[model samples]
Target: MIKATHRPKHSSIPLLALLLCGLGILALGTGAVRMSPAEVVQALLGPHDETQARILYELRLPRILVGALCGALFAASGAILQGVVRNPLASPDIVGVAAGAGLAAVVNLMLLPNTPAWLLPVGASAGALAAFGLVYVLARQSGEVLPIRLALIGVAVEASLDGLRRLILVRADDSIAQALIFLSGTVYGADWERLFRVLPFAAVLIPITLLLHRRLDVLSFGDETAKSLGMRLEPARLVALALAAGLAAVAVMGVGILGFVGLIAPHAARLLVGPRFGLLLPASMLLGALLVVAADALGRGLIPPIEIPAGLLTTLVGAPYFLYLMRKTGRVR
Candidate 1:
């Protein structure tokens, strides 16, 4: 645990929020028919130019919101899981949460092709919880979930789920292209529908996540210490797992398995804000939002005609960081 003395005061919180807003503005201005910040604000407030207003209101704003919210939710989910598992390495992607959601989504789309659009997020959330539940049950020994056990079990389960997902995708043939959107994690052609779909989940889960920070703090204190503090170990872990899975699933519903936002954002926030969950939760959210929005901006701006998937760019950065983390922690401290 990070000592209180090492925890910086709350000064960094506002700074990260400011940076996220600035990045959001810059991201809004990116892409063809680029507008300056002044123009972006003007378009947002009231459209002097019809085309500009349409683009801002219909296209860019919702895309940015989805991307930023997904990033924040993923970060929060990862933070919760890390505390639950008591390992820096635990995240939605790494711990079978994303894979579980992906598999459920694939099954929903491929098998039940005409599945109601409204059921997609629900299916994803259920899948995420089921996968983590499998991991939890398998990883526990003598009613305790050790960090090493959970990480190892998670890796095994993630691999199995991803492998199954790939096989189904290959068989789907015509659906392969469409599946890539969720599998590869792109926000391209994002619209108001997705933003609206995601908003209620965000409104509910994000606050619940913040409220659970103290619970997370307790979970991180190890089984014995946490028990001494009146925390009921098993039930608490189950609730936290469900919350984390829901956050990650809802996030990927729009963005499709964004790599490492879950892992990297919380870790970076931990460096700045210390291991305290209360401060760590919000800081991770802001940094995660900034990361996705910035990555989306760069991806869009890097090439005019072709849009790189935000997941690809994040993976490019996150994969190396993941390696460094593994090396530094030797399967996490």
Candidate 2:
């Protein structure tokens, strides 16, 4: 009798989720004023010493939560975009949403340095929506948006807007620190205030995206096929784009322009879960949260006094993967 081999298929989602939880715990416990697991739990459970409570609740926990939320939102946006466009490389940053939000936020930082904190996200959202609208218009022909054309036009717009952002930064004064946050991508100052600012948008948009997961799977097929199947391809595509871009915009408002989470998370999730949006969507969210939190933790731990921005770390990690992906797909053109 031949020995039978029974190999279980590897499941990454659970591991990724567990990793996110671990990273969150470490993020709360491993800062300058370290706390034990019991103390951390006590701080979380409340009715604890004032100092430890402040450290855990005010300083550390909010940042971790914000990073996790931003990562999940960015990943969901990317998944929605890739499915709608049927292009694996489609992401909010790649498609000009981040550049637009960054540019607008920077402009606000420059012009209205004293503007109420609440207005920053509104400006960023407006900019993102405008940029997305422009890409859609540029990519549309007769009445339909083409995938390749959308990608090409979005890339072009992203480059142009990025250049504009650089030019504005060079000329602007007294906004370098804030601009650096946008350019380098860090959640250094994430707090409950910023988290609350972003929560309403994510709370609403994320559920909507999850609900539309099936529609995304349908949209992955060509437009004619989708239409033949009684799907409203154009409207559905626009709604998905709006939701994805909105999520990215709100996250940028909270955490600055953390690029590549949207791009990388979806690809990783799809590879793990095989393109079924039902599984892929949640998997991307978990992977994304894990990536950002882990990157943020590494950024904090790599040097005691000095810290690297999470955005820079992600770019370092994501750019090479992106290049490899492009080469593999022969999609560099």
> Candidate 1 regions off by >4 Å?
115-122, 331-333
lDDT by residue (97-136, candidate 2, tens digit) is: 8778867877878888786767876787678877888888
When summed lDDT is taken over every stretch of 10 residues in candidate 2, the lowest stretch is: 1-10
Model 1 worst lDDT window (10 residues) = 175-184
Evaluate all candidate structures by whole-model CA lDDT and list the values in order. 0.83, 0.81
Error of 2 at 270 (Å): 0.7
How far is 219's C-alpha from truth in model 1 (Å)?
Answer: 1.3
Which whole-number lDDT from 0 to 100 does residue 328 have in model 2? Answer: 75
lDDT of 1: 0.83
- Mark the regions of model 2 whose C-alpha exceeds 4 Å error after superposition: 1-15, 36-39, 46-49, 176-180, 331-333
Query: Taking the candidates one at a time, how many backbone clashes does each contain?
Result: 0, 0
